[model samples]
Target: MQISRTTLAVLVVWLAAVAAWLVVAKPDMKTVQILAGEMAPATMSADGELPQRPPADADWRPLDQRVLAGWRDPYWLRWRSTAPAVQGGADRALRFSLRGASRLYWNGRPLAGNGIVGRTVAEERPGRLDIVRVLPPSAGAGTDELVVLASSQHQGLRLLSADAFAVVAPAELLYGQAMLPWLIAAFATGALAAAYLYFLAVQRGRRRRPGARLLLALCAVGLALPMVEGWRALVGYAYPWHGPRLFVLLGLHMAAAMLLPAYLARHFGLSVPMGVRIAYPATLVAVAAFMPGFDARSAAVLLLSLLASAGLLLRVQGAQEERGPILALVLAGALAMAVAHSAFLDGPYFLLLAILMGFLLLRHAAHLRALDRHNAKLREERAQLSLQLLQRGIHPHWLMNTLTCLQELIEQAPPRASRLVESLAEQFDRLRDSSTRQSVSLEDELALCRSHLDIVGLASDHPLSLQVEADDTRLSLPPGILHAQIENALTHAGTGACAQHPFRLRVRRDNDRWTLELRSARGSAPHRGRGTGTRYIEASLATAYPDGWRFVQGVDGADWCGRIELTCAS
Candidate 1:
């Protein structure tokens, strides 16, 4: 039930089609004609009579006169009457056709036919007149007269026959030409709004909040205003309106103007300044003042404020590190709307605004999809890096050292060394099996720790103890992330020193975290400079877990120790 950007775009196109139909499809002359009265040539000569001619040598010229004066220019016949005639009938129809263009007058009223004069016609010569009509019995026959005011600026003549009049009703003329299209558009827009609201409600149910829903609701409201206005124009309900309807329409327009900047800023990942929040309410008040008097100055001020807000949004959008495509979409939409607003009413500018807004909405949706994809890719890479780090940490060096010590102890004392070799081999096998995995069980890591302790104990003459307290349940941790701390302790512990020295290794797990502490007598301090082992460990932690792992090392007088804490994988 969602009204996606694509759906809105299609709706916009549909509205455009409706507008085109209204502008391009000529209305039926029979339906629009107001009266069907004949005017003799002599009768037209008198004032207050039908088909009256222009004043002798009158030189009133059409605006943009050059456009019609080109080759094969069409001409119009003009006439005037003494007073405006009111034609009355159940169906006031006056139907007629001409070659190019013609004007009409009733009782000295100049029905200019300005709408048709500027139109171009193909396959026609100059001085020809086309057929046109004005609808309903708005002009009547009591002491009233009718006239046809025609002209051919290119041909420099203004005379035509009286056979061109036809009577028609306004309601019937507009029924097919204007009102129908407007009705369809109104229904479509209503459908779109209902679907959009349904989508917002569903999202609210899932997200358990109304903020996103309210934002979308505001967007729907913005789109609805233009849709309704366009419908009104199509239906011929725009002029001579009731007071309340006009006020509501103006208020809705103001709401749309205020909502647009906020919508664009949020969509493009730009910040909306606090100043805008304060200024928008003030704009609302100014827009409300447009009632009863319709102040053009206040409207101008509101427009200027909107432009300023859009400029502020552009400034913030320019400074963003990402979201370039989204920003570009919003900027392009704003520019298109600006150009459209400045053009004439007949230029279909409102339709252009709809198109641009639809594009911006599409861009916003695409940006969100792209962000989700990027986050998924990051997660995959992290898993891969964690596995690689585990493999590197539990390498062949530790096993080789344990085997060499076992070989030496085999000759000196066979029984204890034999038991130590078995423990070392078991641990090496465990490490080999787990090195390729992303996470190893805490029990497995503890077993490896035990093997390491055996090797260190056998290699040293002094007393060395290793203890591990962890639940047997398989808690997962990256390989070698824990072992590095144990190795650092051994390297600094003076394994070849006098017999009185002692060393200890302890590992414990509590809840979701694992901690390892190693202590030894410092016969000589190891190089204080950074080592490859430490650097590798740190780098791996940074890539795999970021802030999830920590390592600390310190020397207390003659005692050297290291501690590592890591969050276990689920």
Candidate 2:
């Protein structure tokens, strides 16, 4: 799994959120202890004198007391402090328990609670005493007071008692201690995300394998959720119950881990086993149970599942040739997270995972691009071979052979042969001129047909008849394509047989296509024979007029007839 730029940006936001939580809502642990202990007791005075007993809720009077802050629910309140007339240190801490949900504040500073506690709508006892350090008399005398605010959505607070004691140093406060792990987690997750995003951007332009993008997306999501939850936890936004949020966080972590093996298998082209599919999801479920009273048994289950999944991935990597870099990245990220979890080091582990994913994505993309280029080259070579074959079929040898036969006839029959010679010369001249062109006018082809008939008339004892009923001015054809059809008719209508039965040629044009029909008797009982000339004509028609040409041959009574239909070229 690779991390993209978007994922890194998301992690950065999560880090910033955690930082903000630490700054704005962090509890003043030092002040909370002092106010809870000494200031709370001194503030229970009437005017400048000590009160007879704790003030009643309805008859409580607002008096000038020592400056003390109290945190309850989400609110904080502060009041003046005053010393008690009695020199007793019996009340050193303020104790209260919330029936539903509440916060405590002392000296205008909110005390960070252990997050939401107690079960949903479940009855529970109140006044769970939390120890606190007392404030000095000079720090605001005895005028301080403790305040507790209850959640309107749940239950109210029940007051327990107060106490007084010497204040502890700021260094010993719970604020810093609680924040340490969160900060570490943020750093680790952020680093992993950054690395992954960079790799994804660099490789996005290249070709990639199927599911590569999806794998990257899943890895990115997994890395992101942990950072978000860790930040919330650090800021005291996380629920103390740890039933739902913890489960979700653990699930996200497991999902991200599971995606790792699958991603590596695809990136490095390793085969994934069937067991891995079942084990990965099961691992996530096991880890998710951690939030809902997960014990040693649940932890063992999670551990065993993870071990099996890791073994499967390792086996797949070992079977492949290119597994070193991918395996190293996965192992390093996993080890870093493991160490952080054990030590409660809160930082951005996602960042590391992201970087590893980016590397895999880039490798896969490059491989796909190379394969595409190879396939393209092969296609080009195939096209070139096909062109060479076409060139051989239409060479000039056939034309030269026909010209040699016409030359011998010119000297044998002086007058008739001279006419035949002129026609042959005109037909060859036109063919030569149009050799480089794909099409010519239909009128031109008709003239060429007349010339062909003249040459046949001179060579054979039989008469050659031609009837062209066409709007020649509006018609045209591929240069050499139609000529082959005429040649086929002449070749198949044998000269000796044609003396008894004359050969006939007819041409008609309609719409954009022209049709040619030739008829000649066999002079004896018709017998089927190979027609090489016809095959050549059909092949030429197919090559030149691919979209619109048809040739048909059949016996009509005593005559062997061949018909050709072709669309006129524009």
lDDT of 1 by residue, 322-376 (tens): 2333243334434544554422122232333334344444443444455445545
lDDT of each: 0.48, 0.48
lDDT of 2 at 109: 54
The lowest-lDDT stretch of 10 consecutive residues in candidate 1 is 205-214
lDDT of 1: 0.48
- lDDT by residue (1-570, candidate 2, tens digit) is 554454454445544544553454455653444433221222333354322223334233332222221222222222333343223333334433222243445544556542342223332222222333332222343545555432212323221211112233233344354455555455545665665665576556544454566576765664666565664444333122233444455555555555655565554456656786786667566555444333332333334433543555666634332354544444544454454442222233444344444444555556556655654554344334333423422346644554455566655656765776677678667655655554577677667666666666665535565565544556555454445545544555565565466556677767767787766654343433334344445545554554467888777888877778877443
Per-model TM-score, in order, reads: 0.40, 0.39
